[model samples]
Target: MPTQPSLTLAQDLCARLCHDLVGPLGTMAGALDLLDDDAEAAALAREAAASLRARLQVWRAACGAGTGPMTAPEMAALLEGVLGGGRVTADVTALPPGETFAPDVAQLLLVAALLGGEALPRGGVVRLAPAEGGVAVLPAGRVLAWPAALADALAGQEVEGPRQVLAPVLVRLAQAAGWAVSLSAEALTLRPM
Candidate 1:
């Protein structure tokens, strides 16, 4: 049987989720307070709500139970929804048309995209493509930074805090899916074990 996440890891993940949600949730709250006074605030609230929904969907796919296989187009849509807006975008053109990924693989891909987004702090494109019997997540931007803590976590080092939690989570997902994680300045690739 697979090992369950430790209590600390679970708590850190919860913290990370709360951190990600707070900004948009706060925006929505503030906008709603001014909704009757300003028409623009209603639009702001809608945008914030959309961002929150997109984030929740991506998180569900990454951390929740598998929902079965997903086609490339479906995956692309989800990636676009989650990674779109702000400075980052998702490009799925390289994914083969009509191709499908098993639920575990799909989850891994979603987590990989999240990591790719992290690598691009100044806004960039996260490209997903077929790799050697697996998938490759490529992050391109003017300034690419692979966080040191994230790198350590992915290397199976002790996770320091909530900010680096996703790295270990990604490692676990790759392990469960029988994929080997490889990281480089250019891309993070998951190959068959």
Candidate 2:
């Protein structure tokens, strides 16, 4: 196969990452301002706080933004964040036992799921299945392309496209962890091997 141009690829990816992060952060910022200024909106404030906190935590986890390995809280917080948006619902009974993931892995998986969730604008099902080696995220019957970066990362390659900037970091994380990534847009699936 012909090699892709590196500079163009990198720039495209950066633009995508910036694009994804910008929207969520902006929404979170607005929610924070609402909480800061309102006394009567305590319930709404609480929900906003929970949702924003969860989303940001996932963002940090996927980026592995800390000094060392991530703990359970970080992984859980990221999962919670992905779930907090109230857009996608998880059917999690299919997970395996003692299926703990390193922070970076957990972060990648969680964010990938969030990406799948994004495809389901009308809110269908986002189920996480835990296998012996990793989890599988399936976004079924959704009306989106289900971010190609996720599938590429699972296949042990860097992500391609300006709309998928997070692929490199995610690919790096998967490589460092000695993991294999696979995704299918047939229904938006993520499986770790």
Candidate 3:
């Protein structure tokens, strides 16, 4: 039987979702798979669920989803949420006491910061510093691998398949928000003014 367009789209979405969720979920799954039996797996699964839950809750808070206002404490939780293991550590020496970006800004900034974090594989410091208007992404160290197509997206180009993921989206985001960007071979900093 010929596949319906809706089925095709659904299949495509499923593939994308699996591909995206696979990494973290797989890590959790792998941690469980190493266990002896269902009982062990169940326990490990609970831990994994806790991790995912914490990450999701902080992400939701950072993105300002269903939240009327985001505060400094909430942002701190989000910071700690994204940092797992000794991979990264955030030092919020001074966070704005009672200020938060709009929902769209909050979500986009969170997404951009998360994307920046992914660029550092061996894992270094990624700072969300206060810039002129928006913020600056300070990802230190080498092994930085931002998707190349990101530049094109910044120049207002549509990206093709198997690409257009994080960095590109960040470029597009910076553009949309009137955020000015300064990029080196190793870093990308943006400020909206």
Candidate 4:
């Protein structure tokens, strides 16, 4: 990749993260503002702080410095924070006992779950299962429409557009780790190359 393209990719990824974070952050800001009139200011402030902390935990794991190990269940909890309720159910039965993922793979898995959940805006179950040589995300429910260009981007092909932004980052990370990325209506699989 050229220097300019890499820079552009980084910028776009930043934008996507900001877009996702803005909601919780904005809510927290509003809660703080409510302190001026609300009688339950302390409770409201505590609730807002908890929400902020949950979001920060997810974002931290998603964009962490890749220095620590993370488990599948931990990732699921962070993902639950992102989904904000019982909207997405996580299943990690296939993860080996005591197995942990490197920071990058853990982040990629969490992001994959997020994408899978987004594919089912009406709510669904996201399963993390053992694949042939790696892991797979199986989302079952109302499968939303996914653009072909975005699929191409997730498969490591260069593409441009707002929807394609984060998929490419996942693809690049998979590539660097010698993993194959696959996308389909039912599931997304990442496996050894």
Best-fitting candidate, scored by TM-score: 1
Q: Mind sharing the TM-score for model 4? A: 0.83
Cα lDDT of model 3 by residue, 97-185, tens digit:
67776555555566566656666666776666666555666666467766565666566665443333544445545656666766666
**Better candidate by lDDT, 2 or 3:** 2
Order of quality (lDDT): 1, 4, 2, 3
Candidates 2 and 4, the one with greater TM-score:
4
Encode model 2's per-residue lDDT on 112-157: one tens digit a residue.
5666676566666666775544666676644555666666655666
> What is candidate 2's TM-score against the reference?
0.62
Q: If both were scored by lDDT, which would come out higher, candidate 2 or candidate 4? A: 4
User: How do the residues 76-96 of candidate 1 rate in per-residue lDDT, one tens digit apiece?
Assistant: 677675663457888878988
Clashing residue pairs for model 4: none
Give candidate 3 regions above 4 Å deviation: 1-17, 24-40, 54-69, 79-86, 90-95, 161-163
lDDT value, candidate 2, whole model: 0.58
- Indicate the residue-level lDDT of 138 in model 1: 90
Q: Which portions of model 2 miss their true places by more than 4 Å? A: 1-40, 66-77, 81-85, 131-133, 141-144, 149-163, 187-193
Error (Å) of candidate 4 at residue 134 is 1.3
Model 4 residue 32 lDDT score: 79
Q: What is the TM-score of each candidate against the true structure?
A: 0.92, 0.62, 0.66, 0.83
